[model samples]
Target: MRLSHLADYAVVLMTAAARYPAGARLSATELAADTGVPLPTTQKLMGQLAGCGLLTSARGAAGGFALALPAADISLADIVEAVEGPIALTLCSDSNNHECILDAHCRVKPHMGVVGNAVRGALGAVSLTELAR
Candidate 1:
């Protein structure tokens, strides 16, 4: 249930972007410097985020990255899913249900669903602008 470093970094990177004046483009190097994340990792995450439509990249000199949409339109869950895929507390809770022996009669699954919903709600309630604050 722990978020990976990349997910955390994605939040940091996006939060930095949120801090910029809306529509302002920032290079990965600038974002990395601003957030204290490494340059290479920032660039990689920036590319991934752009692919996810969370960011837009411009080419050539004086070009960089900018938010594809308004910060208020973006949520923590969106960033998390964009970087880490689905959110599941346990294998039994996973929609894939690959092969969990307890799938038949898992009492915990129901409770886990509640926990998962709470987590999702909490994440969904916070917009990128809230994080920037």
Candidate 2:
């Protein structure tokens, strides 16, 4: 599955935040400048990430953003899910299954379960700290 630009930027932003000398708060514009991402997009992603609990935002002169938890405690899947929701390879495999016509008769549901588990496992193997490194 291809990650959207927003998802890519989210990773970039999070990784950059991870680089800070722990507890260092950085503004969206600062993150954007550091990562070469557009300022507006970084601001939007920062708000979304903060809302998702992946980031904590402080207000005032020293206001900025920082990870809510340690980099090691956060997984890539957590970031992906926080920004993009569940990881599904197809509509039939989606948790909602709202658009699947073969919900009952699909022969691949069992196999898809295995595939999904493997995918999640692989993603879970890599933590945000690993990505940051």
Candidate 3:
């Protein structure tokens, strides 16, 4: 399945952050300019990433954002999850979500976890460092 635009933008924004020297603080405006993502989108993403503990933020005249973890320690899955919530390929894959009408007789429901895990695993194997490079 294709990633949503927000998830894709999170990856782009994160890779741009990963390109900076470790612990170097950066502003969303700078990231927007660097990655060509719109400023408001970048700000929203920065807030989301920070709220999820993927990025750290500080406020003040010198306020900005920095990676909470090293690039190698952060996976693509983490970035995607920070913006997309969870990596479920189908509604059936999420144990807590029962909104799918097909849940009643779906034969493929049980195997959805395996599929979701495989997708998450593939994404987890790719780190921010690799993406930035």
Candidate 4:
């Protein structure tokens, strides 16, 4: 499945963040300028990423945002999940999903987990360090 534009923007934003020196804090405007993402979208995404524990924020004259973990510790899957939730290829693959009308007779449901996991694994294999480069 194709990723949403917002998810793609999140990845672009995150890779820019990962380029800063270790523990370097950056503002949304700075990230927007660097990554070419809109300032408002960058601000919203920074909040979402921080809420998901991928980023840490501080308040004051020196306040800004920084990655909570090293670039190597963060993966493409983490960034995608931060903005797009879990990487389920279909509704049936999601554990909390029980609203599918074909749930009772769908043969593809069981195997969707493997497909979802494989997709997520492929994303997980790509680290932010690699993307930043």
Those runs of model 1 whose alpha carbons end farther than 4 Å from true positions after fitting are none
**Better lDDT candidate (2, 3):** 3
lDDT score of residue 102 within candidate 1: 76
Lowest lDDT sum, 10 consecutive residues, model 2, at: 91-100
For each candidate, what TM-score against the reference? 0.90, 0.91, 0.95, 0.96
Clashing pairs in 4: none
Q: How does each model score on lDDT?
A: 0.91, 0.86, 0.94, 0.93
Worst 10 residues of 1 by lDDT: 89-98
TM-score of 3: 0.95
Indicate the residue-level lDDT of 104 in model 4: 84
| Count of clashes in candidate 3 | 0
Encode model 2's per-residue lDDT on 1-133: one tens digit a residue.
7789998899999999998878889999899999999999999999999999989999999889999999998888777777888877776676674766677787887687678778878887888888888
Clash pairs, model 2 backbone? none
Q: Can you give the lDDT of residue 105 in candidate 1? A: 85
* lDDT of prediction 2: 0.86
Model 4 misplaced regions, further than 4 Å = none
Question: Which is superior by TM-score, 1 or 3?
Answer: 3
* Model 3 / residue 121 / CA error / Å: 0.4
Best by lDDT: 3
Better of 1 and 4 by TM-score: 4
Q: Identify the superior model by lDDT, candidate 1 or candidate 3.
A: 3
The candidate that achieves the highest TM-score relative to the unseen native structure: 4
